[model samples]
Target chain A: MRVSLKTVLTLTTLFFISACGADDAADSMWRKLPLNNTVLLTLPHGKVVIELAPQFSPKNTAQFSKLTQQGFYDGTKFYRVIDGFVAQAGPKDGSKKDLSVPILAMEADFKVAKDWAYTPVQQQGLFAQQTGFKDGFAIAYQQGKSPNSGKAWLTHCPGTIAMARNNAADSASSHFYIVIGQAPRYLDRIMTIYGRVVHGMQHVQAIQRTAVIEGEYAVDHRDFTEIVSMQLMSDVAKAEQIHIEVENTESKAFAERLVKRRNRDSAFFYNKPPPVLDVCQIPIRSRIVK
Target chain B: MRVSLKTVLTLTTLFFISACGADDAADSMWRKLPLNNTVLLTLPHGKVVIELAPQFSPKNTAQFSKLTQQGFYDGTKFYRVIDGFVAQAGPKDGSKKDLSVPILAMEADFKVAKDWAYTPVQQQGLFAQQTGFKDGFAIAYQQGKSPNSGKAWLTHCPGTIAMARNNAADSASSHFYIVIGQAPRYLDRIMTIYGRVVHGMQHVQAIQRTAVIEGEYAVDHRDFTEIVSMQLMSDVAKAEQIHIEVENTESKAFAERLVKRRNRDSAFFYNKPPPVLDVCQIPIRSRIVK
Candidate 1:
């Protein structure tokens, strides 16, 4: 179900050209993200901008916002970095006991209704009945369920941000992880995914992976990637504030882009395989609103 | 499609215990990999052992072997490393013109026969009609084709090694790249996959990523990760040669492992979603032959 190349070109031209002036279509497709719901995570390499998905996990988002305002993560270190898995960061100390905030209830945030206007890439998924995108987040839903009763959850694709938990479901307090490699979809519907890295994923990948000794990632706290600071975009000074805009997932341009990706007929490809698409492969373009 | 866990455990116990005395099944499933088809790649951090898949891509494997024996990649720097995509190395000057070996023909080795004795993981894939494993290599094939008629190619899973080429398919020569993050399945049937990292993948992940500027990785050839030496295992002395063995994909133990991954009912998982297995997620356990 790929869109034609001609349609993609036409849409791209019309969208950018109209965006230069004033067009409702363009405006609707490329709206500025709310500053209050965004976080600027500063690393040694660069700043990683994340747009919180409060709509998916409201409780966890609120908890994160509160912590950001209190400068809780100012000097925290990315303690556990497993190569091809995740880069985790939280308090300098391993224990979550000293945290001021109470433990937030575990929010599996797995599903929304089937009629939620998601652009489904496949009717079947490795972990769910169907896989798609919702508000720029990779998601999956159960099959054979009624349209009004179906459930969906975020897939753990690269750049996905989720709260790290212990054995218990409600153990998540302050620790969080950003997926840096292949999508660990097995974690879907099992963890609370509240945000995603909209920009500066290269910095995330730049973080040094903990050394492996006998097949286990050695935990050396002293060599961890230090977090300079984590602050809400709204809390930053007016001149220093960073603005971002993500391409609307429901927009025509997005649909066109999906089609182009599914059936890439570019000169780069010698043999064009089928137009099949993975939910994780779908691009959610995010740019600084300079 | 999944082998039962009870069966796997039983087979493991019986195989190991009986094999200590005498067992044909154990001998067949745990055969040692040929040292001639294995490469020992030395990095600053550690040694990465890759087993060449000559059966899948004979020409590329042969070319790679010849290059290794000649020490062409001994001092080459990992010139173009894109985080979460590929770590490309070979030819410090970024040109293949000076290589002694003639460029091999582009091997799209995408498909084998339906009766190739591959263990199927999924009937459908993001890039191919069916996906499975052949000799521990992730592979894909077209559907409904006769046993000897269908095509199958190696998938670009993490740790996959393929030739780096220019716009032309046959341009690949001395340069090669290794997939480091999510499986870039799109590269399947487009690049010539010759080998896979059977052990010391941590060393590959440990390589520092060159800083990216304006969404492009900064190419500072002088600061690249250097290859100490690249040699075929057979070329090394008997005492220094690293003996390796990979889990047999066709064995009953592999089936059980697949089932365990597909339906993880472990105590750690709070909410066990329906088990769906991605072909890339399946483990082809490789260990030093003690």
Candidate 2:
């Protein structure tokens, strides 16, 4: 689906119109993400909305959903924050043993069949055979032995939410982290990525980073950013809830956006280089609906 | 030159042995960057040392040097900080009109000739024909109409120091920014890259980010992170100076490091992915000398 710039602009205009009290118009263009699959994390500065990727990591997402429903993440502190890496948070004492929830078997949903319609950005990525987007998430696919047999996994781009585990693969319970800087592609297939930050990334970036001593983050409990409360969007009252609509990766507008980003011809550029695109560099637009 | 891992490890061991107080051995492998070309930017958290890239952008580097010598950056505030993007700073009030230094002619040192020996990482990049490291900076080179005729420019990777310009290509003056998140490769060839943060990037990342309103950062001067002082390292007393040594891009050790980063068989990685590397992911190791 090839969308022209004018058409995309029109679509964007329509999107805004829908956002500004025009529910019917907005509903036609933007698909509302399931409220049950969304999580609202409140910080002192603002609120961060996360959309779970259940199709990719069902087990991990289910466990996280169960934990959030039980108020397990409320009052948890972001204990470890390494600059240009990740911001890890959970219980203050780092004791997950006391949590009532059973440890989830590790779901390293590293790859999926390439059967789903995906927009390929590159034939090869920094650490993957192919890179593209799947349901608004940046992803990489392995080169299959056959044409349609490849597997795809979520790329560790900034704002990715993943389950934190111990040396054992099945150790992931309540601890989780958000990628806060350059995409740490090294962790792509090693950890289970269940969701991504859909809004309020600035709040996550505002969290005070900890000092590093001998390559380890030296965090103080008192200085940690407190999680005011975490609740599934569905669990919140309708009046107080915030709804999100992610730009469909399969849509024509997204294709246009991809092209515009790949080849920038702004007045600021003295020398326009050839168009090369990274999957993470392509932003998936997310809008809030009150 | 392709260097074997054993040889690199041996050199590293020797380098560590030399670092154990043997000033002579340390000086041999590491070239001492001219202190005159180095800037010490003091932040509330710590001092960030930036090494000028005079070879790539001579005019801009000279202007920056003069500005530092004249104490133009003293008491300046990092007024604009966007998470996973950039930390911009200069004279407050967003005015360079009062600065004593002459406004430099825009030297958009986006690309250089591929004459110097460069360790090429990829035949192609997201926006460039080729990607590699030149003099310890992540760079992309234009695909020349003919071999050896294309130009190269510094990439907008984390810690890269670039001149912030207005809409006009040549309007850069007293404003600059350091990339703090994922590499915004789209900015390549558009801005003037004069230097890079060699040490204390953690301090750079620690700068408090401002709130966002309608996609623009809402900065409050009262909450700004102050630039306590900015001075050339040479201007300081020899006894108080902090020296740095960047890993030679043309050296054998760097090549080995690149390979290791691309493919990891570490205990933590349950399933190691293919060895694909991004030039920005290959860190140019820089350290302080006693």
The model with the greatest TM-score is 1
Model 2 steric clash pairs? A111-A152, A112-A152, A276-B126, B110-B153, B111-B152, B111-B153, B112-B152
Steric overlap count per candidate: 12, 7
For all predictions in the order shown, the interface RMSD in Å is: 4.9, 6.6
* Model 2 reproduced share of reference interface contacts: 0.27
TM-score of each: 0.80, 0.78
Residue A256 alpha-carbon offset, candidate 2, angstroms: 2.2
* TM value for model 2: 0.78
User: For residues A44-144, what per-residue lDDT tens digits would candidate 2 score against the true structure?
Assistant: 87889999999889999998999899888988888888666789988744455436557778766454544455656654344666677767788887756
Local distance difference test, each candidate: 0.75, 0.73
